[model samples]
Target chain A: MLVSTARLHSVLKTAVDGIIVIDDSGTVLVFNDACVHLFGYERDEVIGKNVSILMSEDDAKSHDAHIKRYLDTGEKRIIGQGREVSGCHKDGSPIPIELSVGEADTSEGHQFIGIIRDLRARKAFEQRVRDLQSNLVVMTRVNALDEMGAAIAHEINQPLTAVMLYLQTAARRMKTLEEQDPQLLSIMTRAVDEADRASKIIQRMRSFVEKQEPQKVGVNLASLIDECVELVMLGHKNDNINVISNFSDHDYNLTVDAIQVQQILVNLIRNACEAIKDCKKQEVYVDVDIAATDVFIKVTDTGPGLCEEVREQLFKAFTGTKRRGLGVGLAISRSIAQNHGGDLFVEPYVKGKGATFVLRLPLGLDGADGQSNLASASMI
Target chain B: MIHVIEDDFSVRDALQHLFTELGASSCTYSDAESFLNFLKQVTAKDCVLVDLHLPGISGVEVIKYLRELSDPPHIVAITGKSLAEINKAFTGIKRPPIVRKPLKEECLLREMDLGTALNSA
Candidate 1:
């Protein structure tokens, strides 16, 4: 029996976890070799002292009350459960520890045995994993933004190319005229203004992708939709898709991140174009409406509406049905809309044909109380 | 003579006016097919200014078709698109000169003048 007990003691002392036994009065009765290593305290130093010395001041103060309460109520809180708590080393420095306690009815009296696992290594690993995950997300976003910048360049270049030609032509004509007629001068001025407008469009597009912060300003809905159409139709020439835009008569002006909002529009229009690619008579209609406290832009496509599978996970990331490129466009677009105090969602597919995406943005002087209705209502 | 093929009416008109300003007589065609038709019977020492994008038969296709001719005109491709975007068209034939638009008058004039000098040489 003595040899067996000695073997058991050796096993407990050499275990990975720090083991401690305390009497019902909270005084330490046994401290394993692991405990000594974990706390930087010698076995002799902790064996006869209160177990509270191993805990920080706050935990130490509450240690006695916990034992007393468990003793009086016969209730087990931490006795059977593992909890995260700080342990005080011999040098008075605090370290994180995962501790689990168990109650034993010993011959001397009731004792509490605790198994403590040091959390430093595990915590460090978790932090590293978090850092790597965030880095990956940042990399993916950068790549996406880079592709978008190229597309924006192509889009803006078309108009700028036109601007340069128009202005140069006007200058040549002005030189040929015997005297500068007011009408001719006015036309030249207007052409220059048009070129300036094209540059401004490019500037807005560059700023949108380059700047991290959203810049909010009052924007006219008509011009924004026109810009979106121009952007989507830049490279595509042969695929005959009729895009019709209906804007509200009131200008539907609102204070919001115009560039980001334009991105959402561009994404929706491009999606519409992709959807109707197969149809002989393809059509995408964009309609803007200003409600009492909100503005709604609906993009309707005459494509084979969303199938059962696609409709179920419409706004989910990487769920797009496009054959080429990452499907993060809609996901990122919706995020931008939401960030600008708006919402983007697909209305239900009508039975006969067509799919509608409703982009609802909050509109008001304060712009705080506007709420988007999340109900998908296009089933009929 | 400079033959301009561009689908965009305004761009084509502007190029025509700019050519006139630079003291060069130019003819404008809206698409590649009309220019190709004209190329079949026309005999002239001319340079072709073709836009990359056109309604029917792209500018690249026009270049490919012209390559089969005994005496193809000196070709200059005017485009807003990057050269890489249209680089595939120049695979088998002698690559034509490229001019990126919005058209710079001096660059265009110099390219045409160089082509003329090379022809005379």
Candidate 2:
């Protein structure tokens, strides 16, 4: 069954996407109703005008050249592909559009049919999702900090109490001493050491809890892992879990939001420690390998390996197996990984062995999609 | 005698130093498990200064166990935990005199002496 020209015209007019056909010289030949609605222009007004009128100034300037280049060289730059481009609306505002161009050699001349889809609604929806995700990440951090604050206070107070006692004893001994005694000096030295210990705990806590916008910077992977391990081990001191880390021989510098990456590492390492708590062989192995374009951090535990059932919903939010947490750590960690153009996942479970969680991150922030980076940057 | 039950080695050693400086006999235990094992030697005349956040058997459990004894030792609760947490842990049980961490020597001695006096009464 052959469709008439009138049927094809009607089909183009009723199409959801805007359809516009332009000649090789860049003059708009046919503009359908969808195109009229898309650019706020009538078909009659656009049909005889150059298609450059619907493009931004920069794209408009290169519009004719691009078509001429393809025609002259028979090179298919965008003619056979789709890309996101900026289009100028009738009101002179920029609009994000998905453009796909198809070439046709007709009886009259060369024609390029461009299928354009308005991306305003989609971009707005994406922005909302990103905002919600950012908020959830902050909330997760605050919740974790709240629980950690208690433990930190307990940790810091132990040393603080020791410092106070040591000093008090020294003061009493000094009151009775005829001269400066070596024993009192040793007591004073111990007090100073305890004070330094408490200060270091506060410093680590401050770095973890300080609220800051996400900004990518160069970070040493080995140092970051060591810091996270130390922080996680503070709470698990009595658990007797041994954490061993190995770094591949390479430049360990990578661009990342350090605190955010540390958050993921802390969650992973802590989870590993918790996993091996009940096991006879309690060990957590952290390995960092830098590949050609990406870095991989793997955390392995000697606990009971994950079951098929537990591994299924592992990254889903609010499904934590632990008794205390809201179970959003893995979910938030995965979200952070994806936001960085990376991923977090568990390896295949082996019976009677242990589980390994892998975090893969790009060496550069260029891998992240531009829109999210722009949104995060503007949010600050 | 003042018995110090603390998990941290520094705090345990400092408490021993304080007891020696004050000329009071005292013994220190690293955790609740070890302290409980030595409970057979404790008496009503002795005062126990126990940290609530211990590994293994917890200080609250130790206190409860001591309270169940016919001649329970005088107990002083020493902790870095907040009052609310301490209260929650001691729910429905008689709580001992609570001492906060970064402990003041005077306050701690006062509590220990008060506990011993009450026990011997």
What's every prediction's RMSD, in angstroms? 18.7, 15.2
Question: Candidate 2, residue A226: CA error in Å?
Answer: 28
Q: Which stretches of candidate 1 lie over 4 Å from their true place?
A: A3-7, A132-151, A170-182, A193-380, B1-121
lDDT of 1 at B74: 72
What value of lDDT does candidate 2 attain over all alpha carbons?
A: 0.78
Measured by TM-score, how close is model 1 to the native structure? 0.49
Per residue, candidate 1 scores C-alpha lDDT tens digits across A162-229 of 66666766677787788868877777777776776665565565545544545676666676676667
* Cα lDDT, all candidates: 0.73, 0.78
In candidate 2 the C-alpha lDDT for residue A18 amounts to 88
Error of 1 at A333 (Å): 14
Worst 10 residues of 2 chain B by lDDT: B112-121
Please write out the lDDT profile of model 1 over residues B13-108, one tens digit for every residue: 877777666667778999998888788743336777888867669888888877677877677888755343455356565667887665555556
Q: Per-candidate TM vs. native?
A: 0.49, 0.54
DockQ of all candidates, in order?
0.19, 0.49
- Which residue pairs collide, candidate 1? none
